[model samples]
Target: MWRDLLPIGRHRGSGGYRRFAWTAADTDCRAWFKAQAEARGLSFELDRNGNQWAWLGDPLAGDAVVTGSHLDSVPDGGAFDGPLGVVSSFAALDELRRRGAEFARPLAITNFGDEEGARFGLACVGSRLAAGQLTVDKAHELRDADGVSLPEAMERAGQDPGTIGPDPERLARIGAFVELHVEQGRALDLSGDPVGIASAIWPHGRWRFDFHGEANHAGTTSLEDRRDPMLSYAATVLAARQQARLAGALATFGKIAVEPNGVNAIPSLVRGWLDSRAADQGTLDTVIAGIEAAAHEHADRDGIDLSITRESFTPVVEFQHALRDELAKLLGGAIPVLGTGAGHDAGILSASAPTAMLFVRNPTGISHSPAEYAAEDDCVAGVVALADVLEGLACR
Candidate 1:
């Protein structure tokens, strides 16, 4: 399955992928998903919120067990982050079919839309809409780098923007939601294990900082005559790093935009996004507040304007303890229970479903970048573990 998906969005230079949501690569992935489901004699549907679902049994069956992950990738992201769980889902099903395992309840493999928020600026957009956390109008208004709205993007993906909203009936059908994904950090590597059960996810959020100033010719503008917002932005970046370091939290300015971005021109406006996460909400909030105050001070000093807008925020998510314990027991008590700093579709789904996640070991202990890696053996182990959990939950 991994080999088959290699060419869809593979980057030649870095060998990483750029499968942003609703792009050609993402469309190809959806087509591939449909073909895979058709070959397996399973029915498939694209939900109103743009999530793709492939069912092993009656779609109307009560309390279905669902497993799968998103296909979207961060810019230059490695092979495993989102696709691992998707490939594992199919592999696990193949194993079950090989053994002729019969399920009493419905089993579904889903590929959620926009879990990364790489293009839309809103993570978990698809799941959040399905769970009724985000209104349709607001989702449609989200814009990308080129100023294309979400509605426009959805139309390009062959989905109706008007249909993009809460899917209560569909959401209600999920009795249990289990997403098996490659671990984004070093927990499993530290334990020298192939797999682990997720215990919790740290509180995380994204905020946008916009600095306003006057644009001018870079070579002609005198230093004293210019109000450069870029300077304020730079200072804010440093402040974010220092504050996060002092608070023992995580803060990153991974995405940025400069208006009229040109080497010969001074930018009139600078916009950047800050992704912050911490073990607790208090620490996370404190670190962000400190960074914001610093940005304000820099803006004041530079004679520029600064504004901060929160894009998204997810509080610390503790997986249902009983379910975590149940999975641990089902896995023979050998696997470790671990907490993660990464946010996931599972974290969003937790608000509406009994959500749990199984994490496969990542050898490199890195993610959201080309350096992330998980061994083939570990991936196969993940499939088996996921299949075991499905059998216990979905099969009679």
Candidate 2:
């Protein structure tokens, strides 16, 4: 069951999963999913935004039960980061079938595309587009690092970009959404537990800063004669750290690119992205405002032109407590609810729909890398917890 959900060597022995959506690895994963759904007698349907759904009952239901997660991962993300929830749901459903439990509600397992933003610059692209947060035009305009526009990529993948847009009729069918994911951090482990109910997700967003300066020969220009944009970008990076530290928030300067990058030439321009988050929008605003101020200051000092553009911002998300309570009781009432500093597709759905999450323990606190993990026992426990949660949610 797990193997079908998670193909080993998603990164081909890089000790990490590498299923960026629409890429080779991700497409393979999708094909496996189609096979699994067909075997289970579920009908496969692709939505306007490339989100795939496997319906277990009447496809036209206005309020069906929804359970699943993304299948994409960071460049070298661990196995459980994305696929665990998607797999566990299928496994749980299989177990449910064995018991022949009487059921009346329709169910579906979905695989949302570009959830990690590992390829495209925006995260949760599929869900955002479906929920009307991202427009079809802008989505078509997005490109990967290799300069492949999202529309072109979709066309290449046998999908029509013109048909991608808000999917209210499709989304309204989901009565509630439950995503089972490996605990990206060590929260459950710290509590000495294998599972948890999500309380909330911190607000998070991404922004890009572009700095322009005159490119010149490294050997011909003295230190005082150069208006290097790299200097301003460097200063901005340091300031981002300082501001996040001062505001008690999370911030990162993870991706950057420099024009005329060479050993003997001063860079003419540097463009980079900043990822920032906090528990509240006010705090997040302060964190970003401080970084922007610092960037302006650094640009002035270095005599460089600077521009900062907002990419995407997700507000803080609070999971459905009624469902969370139900999950806790199903898991023996000893379950805990924890908030995450990271953004998630579950969080995005919780904005307009009733949504909750089950988090499996990770012994190591690390995630978004190859070192993330969940022991075998923890994995089994997570499946049990998911089964319990789904049984309860579907029954209601």
Using TM-score as the measure, which candidate wins? 1
Each prediction's whole-model lDDT (CA): 0.91, 0.85
Q: Number of the top candidate by lDDT? A: 1
Provide C-alpha RMSD values for all models, in order.
1.1, 1.6
- Writing each residue's lDDT as its tens digit, candidate 2 over 1-396 gives 675556643666677887776777777778877887898999999898988899888989656778888888988887777788888878878877776755578889988888999888899999999999898888878989889999888888878888988888888888888898888788788899988889999989999999999999999999999999998998989999998999989899999888888999999989999999898989999999999999999899999999999999898888888877877888899888899887777887776688889898999888988888888888788877777677776654
Give candidate 1 regions above 4 Å deviation: none
Model 1, global lDDT: 0.91
lDDT of 1 by residue, 1-396 (tens): 788887888899988889998899999988888888888888999999899999988888769999999998988888888889988998899988887888989999999999999898899999999988899878978999889999899998889888888888898899898999999889899999999999999999999999999999999999999999999999999999999999999999989999889998988999999999999999999999999999999999999988899989999999988878888888999889989999899999898889999999998888878888888888899999999998888887
TM-score of 1: 0.98
Which segments of candidate 2 are over 4 A away from where they belong?
4-9
